[model samples]
Target chain A: MALADARAICPDLATRPADLVREATTLAALRRWAGRYSPMVARDGPDGLMADITGVAHLFGGEAELRADLHARLARAGMAAQSAVAGTFGGAHALARHGGGIIPDGALADRLGPLPVAALRIDHDTAEALGRLGLRRIGDLIPRARAPLARRFGPGLVGRLDQALGYRPEPVAPEAEPPHFGVRLSLPDPVGLQSDVMAGLARLLERLCEKLGRHHAGARRLRLELDRVDHAGVQVEIGLAGAMRDPARIAALFEKGVEEVDAGFGIEAMRLVATVTEPLAPAQIGPARAAPQDGMDDLITRLGNRLGFETIQRLAPAESLIPERSFQVLAAAWSRAAPADRPGGPPRPVMIFPPEPVMAAPGHPPARFRWRRMALTTLRATGPERIAPEWWLDDPAWRSGLRDYWRIETREGPRLWLFHTPQAPAWSAQGVFA
Target chain B: MRCERAGSGALQLAPTRVHEAEGFGRHAFALFQSVCHDGPVVWVGPAHAPERLLLAGLPQGVGERLHIVRAGGVDLLWAVEEALRAAPVGLVVAELETALSLTAGRRLQLAAEAGGTTGLVLIRQGAGSNAAQTRWHCAPRPGAGADSTLHQWSLIKNKRGTLGDWTLHWDGTSAAFHLVAETGERRGPAPPPL
Candidate 1:
C-alpha cells in the first residue's frame, strides 16, 4: 500500500523507515536472551519467537505460567511480544500471529481449523485464490481431495497444509552461540618493555590454558592484543600446524611476534584469545610409547606461524589422465604424510607449466625453435606420446584437443617437453626434464 | 674431454654438512642426493625462481617423503636455517637464485651441525663462494643415447675429499645413476698446438 493511502486511512499513524539489518541484529540478540527459556528457542518470522518448551515448561509450573512469566519479562524489557505453544512449529507459527494459545497434541487440527487460509503459512495470493473458491478457512480445505488442491495451486499449497496439520515434520533449528576463549589482564603500572609484555602474556596464557584444559581443547590459532597508553595498539596472530596448549612452547612461538610489537607510550592492557581450537585428548606418559613427540610437527608449526601454513605443501597422486591434474598439492599441516605410489607408464618431465607458445617452422617435431627468447637447434626427437583430454571434464587448458608430446633434446644443455595440438594446429612447450 | 670411470667408492656427501651444487643439473643432483637419506626432505623454493617438480615425472621414492616449502626472497634463507636447525629430517634442499652471504652460509652450516642433518644448496645463478663442505658444478652432456641420459658432474671444491670430475648415466627405466667413461679430445693443458 502507498504511504499516502495509509495516511488517508489513518491520518494519525506514526511512520519510520525500516532498517532491516538493525532489526535482524536486534532479533538475533533477543533470540540469545530467549535462550533462558529453553535451549531450543528459534525466531518465528520477524516479530515472534518459537520455543520448544516440552520438558522445560514443568520448571515454570505449567505452560500458562511460563507464558505469563515470558510476557511479564518482555513487558519489563519495554518490548511487546506474542508467543504461541503448539505441538508443531507450523501450528505455533500460525497461531502466534493470528490467535495466541496452547494446543495440546491431538487438539492441534481442531484448534487450527477455525483460522483463515493465510494461517497455513501460504502466500497472500494463495489465500486470496482460496477465498475466491469459497475455501477461505483452513477447515473448508481440510475435507477436499488433496490432489485437486495440489493440481490447482501447486505442491507448495498442499505441502504447507500438511506441515500445518502435523502430517509433515517441521523441526525448529536454533542457531548455536560460538565458543569464546579469551583472557585479559589490566596492568596497574604501565610497562613498555618486551620482557614486561612477555610476562603479562605468560600470565594470560596460564589462565587461558586452564580454561582450555577443562574443555579438553587446544588452540590451533591465537592472537595477542596489546593496548597502548597513547597509541591505538597492536595485534599479533599466529596459526599452528597442530593443536597445542603448552604455555612454554606457545610462549616460545610468540617470541618473534612479541619482539616486533611496538609499545607506544606504554602498555596498559593485554588480551590473548584463541580464535580457533580443536579437540585434544590428554596424554599419559606410558611405557615405550613415550618417545618425544615427532619433531616434524613442531617444525611445521613453527614455520607455519611465520610463513602461512598453506605455503607448506606435499604432493599426492590424483587419479586423472590430464598431465596437470595427475597430482594434487595438499597442505602439509592438515594432510597426513602418505607414501607416493611411483607413477607408472611413460617417463614424465621433471618440471611442468602451462603450455607456453613456441615459434617453430612446420614439421612433425620442429628441427629448430625459439622459446623464452632463446633460439636453439634440436639435436634429436624421442616421442609422439599421444594424450587425449578427459571427455567429462571441460577444462579450458585442455580445449586445444589431442596433444602429441615430444621429448626434444636441444643443442644447448636442456631437454624440453614440447607438444603439438592436432585439432588446433599449434606447437607449445609445457615442461622441461632437467 | 677424455674422462675415466671414477673409483669404486661412492660419492659420500657426509651428513651434518652443507654442500653446494650449481649449473644446469643442480636441482636434479640435489633431488638425487635427497632420496639417498632415510627421513623426510624439505625443498625450500624462493619466490623469484618458483620452479617445481612434476610429481608424476618424479621417481617413485622421490615424492613419498618430500615436503615443498615456498618462501619469499629474504625468508628463503631463514626458512632453510630453521629447517636445518630442526634436524629430525634427513635433508634440507634450498634453491638459491640470489646471492648468499658468508655469514648466512656459516649459520646454516652451524645449524646443520647442531641438528645432524645434511644441507644441499642448489645455486641457480651467480658464482658466489660460501662455507659449504663441497661445491659441485653439473651440466647435461649432449648426444646422450635414446635409452640413457648423461650428466657431467665436476666436484670443483671438496673440503674433505679430493676434487674430481665424472660422467653419470641416468637409465630411464631403472631410475638409477651409473658412472660412465667418456673418451674424447682433452681440453685442459693436454696436447700442445702443432
Candidate 2:
C-alpha cells in the first residue's frame, strides 16, 4: 500500500526503520525464556517457535492445562502468541498457523476436516490448484485415493497432506539446547553478593546433577556463565581431573573459579553447562580403603586446573617391540599406572636415545667403532638379535630396513647397543645401556 | 637424599654444569624412582626433551607413572608451580637450563605447600646456591658397581640440615637404590658383581 493510502486508513500512521540487532536480541531472549516450557525449544521462523513438549506436558497437569499456562505466561509478558500441541510437528505447525487450539491425539483428520486445504501448509500455488479441483478441505484429500492426487498435484501436495495427517515422521532439530546437561536460573532480583552466586550455582548444580545421573554420565568440564544486569557475561571454565558425578566434589573444584566471577552490575541470570562429559557408572563395589583414590583425584584435578594438567602425566606402556615406541606418555589425570615389564625379552636399554650413525672397521663384530667423537674398541660382543621393521608402519628410523643388534662393551667401559642394517649397509649406535 | 613428602618441600637435583651428560639423568631418575611409589610424577622439561633418558634408569611400572611437560625456560617456573598444585602428584621435576631466582624459588615452595605436592627441580648446570630442602651433585661411576650405575651422589647443600655423602647403587633388576657407603667415598672399580 502507498504511504498516502496507509495514512488515510490511520491518519497518524507512524513508522521506524527495522532494527536487525533488536530483532536478533528479542529472538535470543525469547529462546532463553522458552526453556522452562521444555528443554527442546526452537525458533520455527521469524515469528514462530516449535517445542518438543513430548513428556513434559504432564508436569503442568496434562496437555490442556499446560497449554493454558503457556498462553497465560505469554499474555503476562505482553507478547501475543498462538500455540498448538499435536502428535507430530507437521500437525502442530499446520494447526498453529491456521487458528490453532488444542488438537486431541488420534483426531488429526476429524479436527482438520473442515479447515481449508491451506491448513496442509502447501505453497499458495499448490493450494490454489487443489482449490480449483474442488478439493478445498483437508478431509477431501484424506478420503480420496492418494496415488491419483499425488500424480495430479505432485508429491509436494501429497507430502504436505501426509505430514499434516501424521503419516510422515517429523523430528525437530532444536537449536543446540546448550549441551543437554545445562541448567539456568533467572533471579527474582539481580544479585551481586558472593553468597547469591554460590546459591545460584547450588541450584543449577542440583538440577544438572539429577539429569546427569539419569543419563549415567559424569561431567569432565564445566562452564559457568553469569549474565549480569548490565548485559555483560562472565564465563569461568573448570576442568576435572577425572569424570565426576558427585555434586560436592564438582562444586569444590569450581570454588576458586567461581570466586573470580565478576558480578558486574549484579547477575540477573546464570547458566551452567557441562561442556565435556563422559559415561560414568557408580562404583559397583567400594574400595577396601578409600583413603587413596578419591583424595588423589581431587588433588590432581585442582593442581591440573590451577597449573595445567598437560604438565602432569604418567608413562603408559604401549604394545610395541620398538624401543622408542615401547612406552607412551599419557596425561596423569586420565591414565592409569602401567603394568610391570614382561620378563624374558632381550635386555632393552632403560634409556632409548636418538639414533646416530657409526663409522666402524670392517669385522664380524666391527673390531673398532667411532661414535660421538669417540673411537671405542669392542672387547666383548654378544648376539646379533635381528629386529625387522613393522611392515604396516612407516618409521624413519626403521627405513634402513632389518637390523642385526649386538651388545658390546667398549674399552672405555660403556655398554652400548649397536645395530647394522644391511639395507643401508651401515652401522649405528642405537642406545647407551647405562 | 630424595623422596620428600608431596606438597611439603621443594628440593633441587643439581648436576654440575661441567658434567651434565655424565650423570644428570642417572641420579635424577634414581631420585624419581625413590618417591614415585607414593604417587604419580610430572616431569616438566624444555622443548626437545630427552624424556626417554629420564625414565630409562628406573624400572618398568615405576617409570610408567611419570608424566612429561616440554616447555621453554620462561614457562618452566609456571609449569613447576602448577605441577606443585596437582594434588595427586607425588613429585614435580623441571629440567631447567637457567638459574632460578629467590622469588621464583619461594613461589614454588608456597605452591608446593598449597598443593601438598613435592617439587624436584633438576638443573642441568646450576651454581651452588639455593633455598631448596636439599641440593645434590650426581656423577656416573660406570665401573663402580656390579653391572649397576653406581652414582656418586654428594650432598652439596643440605637445607634439611645434614650434608652427608653417600654412594647410591642403582640395581637395574629391582629399579631401586642401595646406599653403598655413608662416607661418600669410592675406590676405582670397587669389586665385581656379587
Candidate 3:
C-alpha cells in the first residue's frame, strides 16, 4: 500500500513513480500487434489478452501452435503473457489464471470442478461468506439446490458458477481497431514551398487511392495535415457530393485551402487521410453517363469547398398553399428531389423579405403608398389574391389573420409584390417580381 | 454589358472614386443581366450584403439563373477564383473590397483561361495597372423616375490599346441597349454594357 512501510521492511528497496498514461499507450499498441493472431483481440482487465480464434486456428496450424507463437513474440518484445482457449469466456478466464491449456468442448465443468470457489472471480466478502457455509471448492456448490443457493449467496454467486460451467453465454467484446484510409510522407529535409507541399500531398493521395482501390471504397471527406518543424500543424478538409478518387481533381479542390496554410519554418511531414468513406461498386463507364457525372461531381465539390458545404442548397417544393411553407431548402449534395411545377396559378415572387409596413391610401387598391424609407408610387395594380391562414397549423407568422396580395409596378421602374392584412391599417412589401 | 465571342476575355468593372456610394453591389445585377450567358451566374459577396435584392431590377428569367455564394469579406477573392476554375457557370460576379495585388489579378486571369469562365469583380475602390482586358468606370444616370436607363461608362484600359468614353441607354420594356453618342452619331441597340 504505502512505499514507506514497504521500505521499512527492506531498507534498500527501490521504487519509481507510476506512469499510467504511458502504460495505457503501450497496452493499446500491444492490442494492435495482437491483431496479427486474430482480428478479434481484446485487453482482458489491466494485464491480460483475449483473442478469439474460432475458425482461424487452422491458419496457424492449430490453437496451441498460435498460442506458442504469440507467447514467443511477446517475450521478445519484453512482455510475459499467459493465454488459454475454452468453450466459454469465464472458463477460459478461470483456467488461464489457474491451469492453462486448451480445454475440449463440454469438459469445462469436469476440469474446473476441483478448483477453489474463489476462482469464480467473486470478491473477498463473498468468498469468506461461502467459506462460512462450508463450501470450499467449486465442486462443493455443484450438487446444491440453485434456488436455495441463490437465496443465501445472491444471484451473482450462482451466475458466475453457471458461466464457468458453460451454462450461460458471456461473450467478450474486443476493443476495435481504428479504421483509417490514411497515407503519410516524411521528407529528408524540411520544405516550406507550396509546390513541395503539393508534391508530398500528391504522393500521399496516390498511396491512399491505392489502399481505397483494394477495399473498393471512395472518400467523401478528405483531411490534409501538414506538420511543421515549429510544432504548428495546419489541417484542411474538403467534402464531396459523391465518392471520388481522382487525384488531380481532389488536389485541385484543395488548392485554395492549401495556399492559406502557414508553413512556419518548414514542414517536415504530410499526411492525407480519407476520414469519411463509402463503399463504391466497380462499374463500367457507359458512354452517355460518365462525362456528365464526372463534371457534375467536380462542380459540386468545388462549390462546396469554396462557399461551404451547407451553403449550397437545393429547393424542393412542399405540399402547402402557404407561401413560405411551399418550399424547403435541402443540401445540394445530398438531395436528388426536384420541386414539382404547379400550373394555372399566379407566379410566386422571386424574393421574399420581412414585412416592411407601408401607409396605404384608404381605397380599393391604394394608388400610392409610403414604405417608410421610400414613397412608392403605383403605376398599375393587378390582384386581390387572398391567402388564408391554415387553422389546423399553429404558425407564429400567420397570427396576423389573413392577407390580400397584389402585384404592382411602381413608377420608379421596379415591379413589387405587396400584401395587405385587414387587421392593420397598412400594406407590407413581401416579394419582388424583378 | 453584352456577351462578345471574340478576342475579348473576362473584364473587371469598378466604380470610379467619386461614385463609390453603394457601388460594390448596387449595379452587380445590372451588369450581370447585360452580358450573362446561358448558364447560371454565381454572385459572391460579404455575408452581410443584401444578395436577394440583386435580381430585382433585371428581367423575369434572369432571377432564376443566379446562384448566390456568401463568403467572408476577406475570402471573397478566393471564392471567386475557385468558382471560375469550376467552369460549369459562364459568369462569376464577385463583390469585394478593391485591395487586390498584381499576383492575385494574374492568377484570376490564368484560372479564367483554363476554365473559359468570365470574371467580373465589382469593387468600390480603384486600383492601378489591371490585368483585365477592359476596365470600365461606371456611374448610373437614372431617368429621374422613369425606366429610360442611362449609364455613363469610361473605358480606362483596353487590351488593343485604344481608350474611349460613352453614355448608353436601355429600353426597359424592350430589354435592349442603345448607344447615346456624344455627337449624335451612334444609334440602335447597343453592345452589352457589362
Candidate 4:
C-alpha cells in the first residue's frame, strides 16, 4: 500500500519496535570483520559502516574487487549492505545513499548534486521548509545565497550540506592497547613431552626478559598459553614478588605453571605473555660485595605458579591510626610505594589482631586478661597516647569516646598493647609484638 | 694401656686414644648464611575465619632486617612487583579473596622478572580464573599421631615438577613436613616422625 493512502486509512498505526541493542551488536561485529579489509573503520550510523581502503583496495585486486568481497561477506551474514568509496566520511555517506558506484575523490559534489536534500540528514521540518521554498534537491540549494540560507533555515543546514560534499574532516580513534609482553612459538609438529614444553618455555622466557631489559621494565605476572591439537588450550600464569627481568628467575616462576599445561592430544602452539609490567631502575653493584643468590625469589615463583597469586601477600604499614587499620596485606605483584617517616614515638607492634576486649583501668595495665584461652599479666606499662576520631567521617565506635593506647610488656615475654576509651570505660587488646 | 695390649695382641690396639674434641668456644659465629627453601604461604580454615600461616617460615634474625608492608586497596600484581624490587630481605606473601585482570597479572609477571625477587600469591580456590603457575587444591588431612592437635596436608598439583600426589603430615606444635605413604600402596618405608 502507498504510505499516504495507508496513513489516510489508519490514523493510529503502531510502528514495529526496533531492536537497537541487536543492531548495535551487529554493527560492532561488522566493524571487527571489516578490519580484514582495512584497519580504518568507523560506524556511519545505526545501519552503516565507513572503511578507508585507499591502499588496501589493491589487496583484493582493486576497488571493484573489494566492493564485491564486501557485498559477498555481508550477503553471507544475512545483511543487506550498500557501499561507496569517497575521499571523506561525509562524501562516502552521501555517495552510498545516492550514487550506486564508487565515486572518485573530488567528484562527490557532482555525484550528490541530484540527490534530495533529505540525504543531508537535515530535520524533517527543515526539509519540508526547503521543499516549500522550491529547494527540492541539493543542486537547487547549492546555488542559493549563503547568507539568506543561513538566516532562514539556520547554519546547521549549510553545515550538513558542506559536510556532505567533504568540506569537514572527521577522525576515527582506535582502541587502546593492553599492557603485556608476549612471545610465541609455532611448533613444526605437535609435541606431548613435558621436556619439550619446558624447553619451549625457556626459549620464550629468554626472549621476554630481553624485551623487558630493553624497555627498562620488569613483569610481576606472566602467562603461558598452550594451544593443543584438539582445538582446546591450556593457560598458566605465575606472579612474582617484584618487577624482575631475569630470565632464570622468570623461568623458575613458571616452572610449576608449565607442568600444569596439559598437552591434550599434543600441543601445537605456545605463547608467553607478561600481564603486569613496571619500570625497573638500574641496580647498584659494589666491587667488594658479592651478589647474593636469589633463592627466595625462585621459591616464590614456583609456589605462586602452583598455588596462585592471591594466596600470597606481604604486610605493609598503612596510614590509619586505628590499630587494625594501621597495617595492610598487599599482593606480591604490586610494587609498594616507599615508606614515609613515621611520627616520632615508641615502636608499634609488628603483628596486630582484631580488637579483643580487656578488663583494665584507663591509666593502669591489666592485672590479668583472657586471650585465646591464655591469661596474661602485664609486667610493664607505658603510654596514654590518646587518638581522636575524625568527626567528619561517619564512625559508630568513634561516637563512644576517644581511646588512650598503652604499650605494656607481659610476664610471658610477649608485649601486649591495649587501648581504653574514656566514654565506654572498657579496655581492648589492639596488637602484639613479634 | 700397655698391660691390656700384652694380654690380647689380636684385640687390643692400645684402645686408641679416644679423646673427643670440645666445642669451638673461642670462634665468633657468622651472622649470614644461605639456605635452600621451598613451599608456599598457607591460610587454613573457612573463608569467614581465615588464619594467615607462613609456610616457608622466617629466617633467623629476620625481625631485625625484614620489612612488612601493609598495602590496602592495592592490586595483587603491584604488591608482587613491590616485593620483587625490595630484594635480599624481600618476600611478599598475600592471601587475596579477590581476582585480578589480565593486564594486572601481566604487570606482575614483568615486575617479578625485573626485580629478581620471589613473589608468592595465595588466592582462594575458584575465586578467579585459573591462571597461576601451578594451581593447587589443598585440603585438611586427618591427624595421625600422639599430637592430637596436628593437621595433615596433601600436595594436589605441582605444575613446575612431577611432585606426584603426596600426603604431608604436619604437627602444629613443630610445623614440620612428613611424607605419608598412600593407604593402598605400601612400597616404601614409613616416614620417620619429627
Candidate 5:
C-alpha cells in the first residue's frame, strides 16, 4: 500500500525508532570534527552540536564564512546540518529549527512569535494544556501575568520561554582534548624506495624533534604511518626508553622497527608521530667536558627494545608481610624507583621462591632440606618469628595454622629461608629469601 | 704516653693546612665541580629486563650519565614531558595498546619543536589510530646463504623520505643494519592462489 493510503487508514503513526547508541556515536564524531572550527565544541543533544565561536568567528573572515565552511564540510561528509548564530544557545537552537535564517539574535521573540507551541520543546501534555487555555502562540502567552501563568503551567514552561528569549544563562561544556603527536609529509608522485622512505622519515624526525626540543619534551610512544596507493595504509609504532627529542636517535629507533612492513603494491605517503610525550630537563656539562662511557639509561633503552618492555622487570615494595609477597615485579616503563629498605630490618635473601613442603617435625629445624634435587644440612637455626593469619578474611590456608618463621644458617652459608609450622606439630619449608 | 696523647689531641683540634697548601680541598673542589655540571640521564623504559639489557649494552662512558626512572600505567605524552624535564638528551620509548589524544599529540609536537633533543616511541602494529610522522612496521625474516648468519627486515613506513619496500640484511651479533637485495616480493611467503 502507498504511504499516503496507509497513513490515511491509520490516524496515529510513529515513524522514529529509539536507537540511542547509534545516535550518540554519530554525535560524538560530529563533535570531534567540529573542533576544527572551534576548540570549544559540545554535544547539545543526541543530534546536535554547539560550538562557541564568539571571538573565533573572525578567524574565518566572518560569521557567514564560518557558517558556510561548516555547511560545506558537512555536505562533503554527507550530513544535513542547520546552524544559527545567537547570543544564547536556546535562542540559536529555536531559531535554527523554527526561523531558519530570517531571525537575528535580538529579535528572537518577534521571529519565534508565529511558530507553533510545539517549537518550545514542551511535553505533549503541556502543549495540550496550553491549547485548552486558548494560548496558541508564544506571543499570545507573553501578555499573561507571570505568577498566574506559572501557577497554571508549572515553572518549567516559564523557564523554557525565558531561555528561548535569551533571558536565562546557558553554558557549553567543551569536549576533552585527545593525545597525539604527529608530523606530515607531502610527497611528489609518491616514491616507493626504502632509502627514500628513510630519508623522508629522517626529515620528519628532524622536524618532530625540533618541536619536542623547543618544549623540553620527548616522546615515550611513537607511531609511523604509510598512506598506500590503494587508499589504505600501514602503521608501525615503538615505545621509548624515556622521552627523547633527538631526530637521529628517534630515526635510529625506527630503523629497527621499519623492518616489518610488507608494502603490498606500494605506499604513496608517510607520516610520523609521537603518541606519548614527557618533559626533559637540560643536560649538565662536566668540568673536564669528557663524555662518559655507555650511560645507564642508554643501556636500558637498548635492552628494553630487544627484550620487550614488559619483560624488563623491577622490584617494588608490596604491602604483604609474606616473604613471597613482599616485592612485586613491575614493568620499567611504568614503575618508579624501588622503595628503600626498611630501617633495622633483618637481612633479606638474594632470591626467593614460593613455599616448598618438607618432611619435618614441629619446634625443630630440619637437619637436612631437599630443594630442586639438592639437600642442604642446617648447622644453625633462629627462633620462629610468629605470624598470625589475618582472621578478618576467610582464607583456607589461614585455617591450616599459625606460622613460626625461622632463619636457618646452613653449613655452606647463611641462606635466608623460611620454615612454617601450619599445625602445632608439623613444620614445612615455605620460601627462599632474596 | 701523656705527651703523645696531648700531641694527637692538638692535631685533631687544629684546622688542616694541607688543603690550603694544595690550592683547594679535593672534596670541596669536587663538590663544586659536580654542582656546576649537569646531572645524569634517567633511563625510562616499559619494563626492567629490556631496560637493564639496554643499559648494559651502552658504551661505558654513557653509563655514568644515566639514572633509571621506571614508569607504570603512564600515557605516552606524559612520558614525553617527563623526559623533557629529566634529561638533557632525554629519550622515552613506550609500548602502547591505544592511541594518544589529539591534544596530547599536539603538545608533544610543540614540545619536540622546543627541545633540540629526540623522542622515540614504539607501538604495536595496527593497534591504534594513525597520528605519527614516520611509521615503520618491522618483522623478522629468514637469513641468506649457507651459514644462516644474517636476518632480513622490511621497511614499511619511512616518512623521512625513505620510500618503497626495501630489505635490510641484519647481522644479529653486530646489531647493525645492511642494505639487502629487494626481491620485489612481499615480506612473507606468498599465499596460495584461490
Candidate 6:
C-alpha cells in the first residue's frame, strides 16, 4: 500500500525507498555463499534461493536435515529464510513460498494440491480468471481435461502445473564466478624510493601480462595498491585509451601516477590488478606498419593521461538542419576519426554560445539591441533563413517555435547570428561569426 | 624553418617556427589552413575561451584532420608545447586571451623546430614582445562589396624579410587568398567589383 493511503488509516507509517539494484547484489552474494550446500544453487526469485541437491543430499545425511541446516545457518546470521526440497525445482520453489517442507519422492502432486492456484506461478490475472471458474486450488486443475483448459487458460497455465508436478523438467543453472587477474609482491625490508616501488610494479606487471596473454585479453584499466608501513594504504588507478599488454608500454603510462604514492615510513607490499579488460588477439609487428600512425596514437594517449581523455575532441559535421545539431564533437580517445564529407548548408558561425535573451527594438532585423552589456546598432543585415524545429523531438530550446535567423554586422565590429521567433515573438543572440 | 611562397606571393607561413597573429577577425586562420595542406593540425585553447571554429564553415576535409584541446590556464601553454612537439602534427594553433612571455614563446618555437611543425599563436588582446619569427595585424576592411570578401593583412614584424601590408580577396569555395593590391588606410566607399 502507498504510504499516504496507509498513513490516513493509521496516523504514523514508516517507509523507505526500495533499491532494487542493492537487493539484487545482496541476493547474488548470497547465491555465491550457498555454494557450500550444493554446487548447483541458483536464485529462485526476488526473495528466495533454489538449490539442486541431487547427489549432495547424502552429505548432509538427508534432504530434511540439509534444509534444516541451511535455514538454521541463515537464521543464525540474522536472516529469516524458508527452505523446501523436492524432486523438481518448480515443486521446491512453490513449496518454499506457499507451503514449505520436504516433499517425498513421487508425491509432488499430493503435496502441491492444497496450495492456491497462484502457487502454480501463473500471473495474478490468470489465477483470478481460474478462481472465477471454481478452480481455486491446484487440486482443482489436476483432474480437468487438458485440451479445453489449455485452449482457455493458455499454455503457460498448464506448463507451470506440469513443472510443479515433476511432469516437466525445470533445471537449476548455477551462476559462475569470474576469474580475478591480480598479482601481489611482499618485501622483507620496506622500500621508500619511487624506483623501488616501480621495480615492484614491473615484476607484478610481468606476471599479470602473462596471465592476460594466456586468456587472449588486454587490460583497459589497472589499479596499483601500495601498503605503507605507518600510513594508510594508497591506491593509484590508470585508465588506458586502448587495451594494452606490453610491460614496457604499461610502465610508461604509469610514470605520472608513480609519484603520487606517499611512502609514509616505507612500503611493505604492493599489489597490481587489472580491473577492466577486453579481448585482444595478438598481432604480428612488421617493419611495413611500424612507422605509419603509432606516433599519433602515442601522442593522444600521453596527452589524455595528463588532461582528461574527453577534453581532446574532434568535430564532425552531422546531418541536421538545427545549427547546434549540425555538428558533433567526439572524444578522440574512443571514436575513430570520422571521414570528412561535403556538407550542404548555409554558412554557420565560428563560435556558438547557448542562446541568451537580447533586448531589441520592434523592427524586421532589429536595428538596435543590447546584448552582454553592450548596446549595438546594426550596420548591415542579410537573412531571414527560416528553420523549423523537428516536431518529432522534444527540445526545450525550440519550445518557442520556428526561428528566422539573420547574420547582422554590428557597428562594434563583431558579426552576430541573431534569431527571432515569430510564434512567441522574442529575439535571442545565439552565436558570433568570427 | 622553411618558408613556402604562396601562389600570389602575398602571405606565407613558415613551418617549424612560431608566428603571432593579433585580433580575432583577421585572415590568419584563413591563410594558415590554406598553406599547410598536409599533416594534422592541433588547436589548443583555454577552457574559458568562448570562441570555437565552425566545422561546417571550414573548407572540405579540414575539420577531419583538426584536433581541439581545451586546457586550464596553467596547462594551456603546456598543452600547446606538447602538441607542437608531435611529429605527426603539421601545425599547432594556440588561442590566447592572456599574455605570452618571451621565454614561453621561445620554448614553443624550439618544440616546433624539434618536431618539424609550425606554431601559430593567436593573441586577441595583449601581443607583448615575443621570440616569434613574425607578427601580423589583420582586420576586415570596412567597405568591401556585399558579395566579395576582403581583409587587410599587415606584416608588422618579420625577422627574415621586409614588412609590408596588402589587401587580399578570399575565394570561399576554393579556400584561396589572392593579393588584390598594396593599399594605404582609406575607408569610404566599397571597393570596385572584382
Best candidate according to lDDT: 1
* Per-residue error (Å), model 3, residue A246: 1.5
For all predicted structures, in order, the TM-scores are: 0.70, 0.61, 0.59, 0.53, 0.51, 0.73
Q: Rate the local accuracy (lDDT) of all candidates.
A: 0.82, 0.71, 0.69, 0.58, 0.56, 0.79
Candidate 3 residue runs with Cα over 4 Å from true position: A1-84, A87-109, A112-179, A227-234, A240-242, A255-266, A283-307, A333-344, A372-375, A390-397, B1-36, B49-66, B72-74, B93-114, B119-194
lDDT for each residue of candidate 2 in A1-434, tens digit (9 for 90 to 100): 98779888999888777898888779878888888888988877677788889999999999999989989998998988888988878778878887888888899888888888887768898889889989888888889998998898788888888877878876777776434889999998999888888888888899999889888888999999999888988998988877877787788777888888777778999999999999988666666554456766776676578657775566665677677776666777877665645345566655556778899999968999898887888766776899888889999879889989887766565567898887878888877664
CA RMSD of all predictions: 8.2, 11.4, 11.6, 17.7, 21.9, 7.2
TM-score-best of 2 and 4: 2
Residue-wise lDDT of candidate 6 within A183-254, one digit each (tens)? 999999999998998998999999999999888898988999998888579898887777778887788778
Q: Candidate 1: which docking quality band?
A: medium
For all candidates in order, state the fraction of native interface contacts they contain: 0.66, 0.41, 0.08, 0.02, 0.00, 0.55
Q: Rank the candidates by DockQ, best first.
A: 1, 6, 2, 3, 4, 5
- What CAPRI grade goes to candidate 3? incorrect
Give residue A114's lDDT in candidate 4 (0 to 100): 85
- Give the alpha carbon lDDT tens digit for every residue of B38-138 in model 5: 44333344432221222222222233333444554553345554444322443333434345555654555455445432333444444432344444333
Which structure is stronger by lDDT: 1 or 4?
1
lDDT of 4 by residue, A138-158 (tens): 989888888899999899998
**Listed models, DockQ each:** 0.54, 0.26, 0.10, 0.03, 0.02, 0.42
DockQ-superior candidate, 1 or 3: 1
Candidate 3 residue lDDT tens string, A1-434:
68889999999998889898888888888888888887887887676777777789889998889878887888988887677888887778878888688888888878877778888888889999989988988889888889998998899999999988878877768955655799889888999898989888888888888788777888999999988998788898999878888787788878878899999999998889899999887667666544544665677677787667666555555667777766665666776634244323665555566676778777657788876466767776778899999999999877887999987766654456788888754578877552
Q: What's the lDDT for residue A424 in model 1?
A: 96
Runs off by more than 4 Å, candidate 2: A1-180, A187-203, A210-216, A246-266, A282-291, A299-312, A358-383, A408-416, B1-22, B25-28, B53-60, B113-116, B127-129, B144-149, B160-169, B175-194
| Reference contacts reproduced by model 1 | 0.66
* Candidate 3 per-residue lDDT over residues B1-194, each given as its tens digit: 44343424232232110111123223533443334354556666666643344233334344444555666755677777776776566566666666556787778777777766776666654653356655666554534434334555566666655666666664322234566756633687887889
Error of 1 at B56 (Å): 0.2
Q: Candidate 2 — which pairs collide? A: A299-B87, A303-B85, A303-B86, A313-B67, A350-B56, B6-B116, B7-B116, B7-B117, B7-B118
- The alpha-carbon lDDT assigned to residue A108 of candidate 1 equals 80
Q: Best to worst by lDDT, what's the order?
A: 1, 6, 2, 3, 4, 5
